[model samples]
Target chain A: MVAENKGIEPGGGIVLDGISHAYSGRKALDNVSLTVPRGESMALLGPNGAGKSTLLNILCGLIRPDAGRAIVAGVDVSKHSSEARQNIGVVFQDDSLDDRLSAWENLEFHGLVYGMDKPSRARRIDEVLALVELSEWAENPVRTFSGGMKRRLEIARALMHEPRILILDEPTVGLDAQTRAKIWSYLNQQRRERDLSVFVTTHYIEEAESCEAICVIDHGKVQVQGPPADLKARYGTSLIRCLPRSPEVRQKLLEKYPEAQRLSGDRLGIVVRDQAMIDAFLSEFGSSLKEILIDEPSLETVFLAITGREMRERDEVNSKARGKRNKRI
Target chain B: MSKLTILGRGIYAIWLREIMRSFRDRGQLIGGVSRPIIWLLILGIGLNPYFRGEIYGEVRFVIPFTYLQFLFPAVIVLNIMYTSILFAVSMIWDREFGFLREVLVSPLPKWAILFGKILGGSTVATMHGFLVLILARFADVTLGWDQVAWALVLMFLLSFGLTSFGVILAARVRSFEGFGVFSNTIILPLYFLSSSVFPLDPSLTRTQTAATYPEWLAMLVQINPITYAVDALRGALIGFNQFDPWIGPSIIGAGAVLFFFIALVDFKRQ
Candidate 1:
């Protein structure tokens, strides 16, 4: 038992060690180990049914793993979950806000739940609301807030007590691209300003690139973990996108490159093996082609190379499986 | 002391949220206020004549009180039962809407969270019970300050027990859609079976009582814990007793402790 500072309240960032949880007979997490040292950011990248939520639940002290030690904020979670919860703030995958209450009321409730003193509660309420740019709408009920506003308020409420470790489970799932970008900027700013360690689970590959470290999980196992640049350079692929002028031209391109695959919007994509392939294609068909664009190696291409499937294609297949597991946790 | 203060803040926060929600809901408030008015003002007055009328051509009183006075405290109990037992709906709302997870991840213990919710529910129920006392004058029943104070304490205790029982119901019922109908089924049956609307003659011995009324009806009044709760309030406000005085207060006190423990156990498991 590692003693926390001053007394027995849990303190520090996440330290999940060999933590494994199973639902009846199905294993959701299998010998998972990860660490987010104090004041750092780590993104958990996984598709649906990849155990991201299960991992987040364990970190937030919502579920106790069947086998292994989870030391969240220096406290053994299975033994003292309440204490472990002290240093951890969670924005769950689902909308957990009480829409009936005002934005201020929700923040007030959060502060009190975390045992913030009256003055501090008042002070932090204003600070966090401003951080999310929701200060003017504090007294308005959350029911009237748009989805992006609700997401923003949820983030503000989670930061009310200034938790040492912040755990967000798919924090920006269904929002528009602009709102998604805004939320990420707020989170990045929070990380920079506070001594906060963030462990966010997300399937958005482009956004995951912003984290200091990335862990790609699939089938309840860690497929890879490293900085974004390293993972991209090693597993990522550059592709050439070409729109043929006619059926004859498309046939000729496919004949020359047998591996070329049809993409959306009448585009054909060919994985670039080397620089010579691009030179040969451009010289051969640059004038004849309707359009040609070279996509640089990115997290999307890295995900494709590692997982062997586009992230969106796996959505429907695993959703039912994920739903069954979600009910238990 | 520090730990206690922290737990206190957490409890107070949760309790305050429930109270605020109850206040904001116009529909629940209407039900709480109007329920007692209809039962006491109309039902009691309309039935007052027959409570003291001739029985089988023999002039007699059922006990010694008019129907209005006899039904007053039980009406308070009825009001409290409606508010407290249906407090489960609030729990269901929280669960269905995902609001419960916010507090579950906080530093508060499971027991504290449950206690705060039960406390909030009982407070609202007790207020509904208190609303009935304003009609004491209308019912032709006078009360001293002490009686009113004692009645309030008893009402609070009963509400506490019933609110905890509501939590037990909420834990069992998963869907919010069916809980209102399901709780109505439970509340109305329990209210009717508790002898809230009628009095069982206690002057006769148990065997004679069984012969006079249907055996099942007599048995149900005695067996239902709510019967004693109503009887206890009746004793406090109207100086009435249908059974041994000790039985009413004892059952109420015991039920408050027992049901709360059941709720706490269920809450911890969740």
Candidate 2:
């Protein structure tokens, strides 16, 4: 047994070793092992059914892994979940705030649950309100707030205890691009200012790019793990798109650039290993092409390449499977 | 500072929040109080002539005050029991709304959450019970200071036991519909079978009727913690037979503690 610390220690991190979990013979997480170093922001990028939420729940001490051990802030979460949870903060995938309560009341009640004294709770509530940029609406009922506002409040609630390790499960799902970007900026700022270790699960490939490191998981297992840029450079190739003005023109272009992969609608995608290929393709077919696009391989492409399906499609399939499983039970 | 103090504070806050929310819900507060008031008035008046008789050379009093004096105390226990069950149903809503997860994940001990909810529901039950008693005073039932104090104590103990039982049921229940079925299957039967409405005379055929069901039901009533509570209230408000004076209240207290620990264990499993 490790001794409990009275205060935050430097270089505190999370380590999960050989963690496996099953629900009614269906494996949710399969021997997943990962580490998040102190002050490192890690993104868990996965298609649906990749066990991201399961892993987050384990780290947060909400669910016990059926096999192996998970340590958070030097405490084994499964064995000492209450004590372990004291050192960690989590924002669940679903909205966990009391909608009937005002924003300030919600924070106050959460602080009380964490055993904060009145003075400390009041001060911390003010600080967190400012941190989430909701000081103006702190007294307003949470039900009246927009989705983005509610999500921000949930983040603020998690930060009330000043946890050393923060775990967020799909924090920005179903949000507008602008709101997502704002939340991303706030998280980045917090990371730099507090040097807090953050573990996040996100389906959005663009959000994954902002993390210091990324772990791509598929089918309840980690497929690849590394820095985002490094993973993209390793697994991703640049793609060139070409669009012909007419059907006859498109057929001719397709014959000419037989290497190009046809995307969903009227777009032709071609892998460009070097700038010479782009120049040659443009010079040869520049007259017939109505539009052209060039981009690096995205997180979506990396997921498709590794998982053999798009993230959205995988989510639909997983939901159907879950519905069937629920019916059987 | 210590785990105990942390738990204490958590329970206090949760209890306070529940009270505040219950008061805010106008329909719940009004319905909780009014249901018992209506029962006391309508049933007490309607059954007054029916209970007029002499049994075992003792004169039978009318229903409202005479019968109500006996029934009112039981109604107080019933009020607490019913309200606690209703509060348990609200737990289903809490589960669906994601609030239960928040409470479970708090740093406080899991038992604290269970006790907090039990305390909250019991407090509401006690309040409603008191309202019925005060309204009974207007219905011509006289009570001294000692009787009122004793009645309050018994009401508190009864609420604690019933609330603990409700907590145990709530933890086991999965859905609102399931809780509804349980409420119908358990609450009504417990109310009718117990010596709530009429006196328990071993010679009465009604007593025989209670005996015909099962040993468990008879034993439950014989040991029915609520039976002692009703007896204590009857002895205080109306002139009724009191048996095993100290043993009854003591047993009810013991039962409350037992049920509370059982509910706590169930909460930990959840």
List-wise, what DockQ does each model earn?
0.73, 0.63
Q: What is the lDDT of candidate 1?
A: 0.84
Give the distance in Å from residue B4's predicted Cα in candidate 1 to where it truly belongs.
0.6
lDDT score, residue A276, model 2? 95
TM-score, every prediction: 0.88, 0.83
The CAPRI category of model 1 is medium
By lDDT, who's the top model here? 1
For model 2 the local lDDT of residue B14 reads 88
How close is chain A of candidate 2 to the true chain A, as a TM-score? 0.79
Worst ten in a row by lDDT for model 1 chain B: B202-211
Pairs that clash in candidate 2:
B48-B63
User: What lDDT tens digits, residue by residue, belong to model 2 across residues A105-191?
Assistant: 899989988888899999999998898899999989998999999999988888888887888888988777777878877777777
Give the poorly placed runs of model 1, Cα more than 4 Å off. Answer: A1-12, A239-272, A275-295, A313-329, B53-58, B202-212
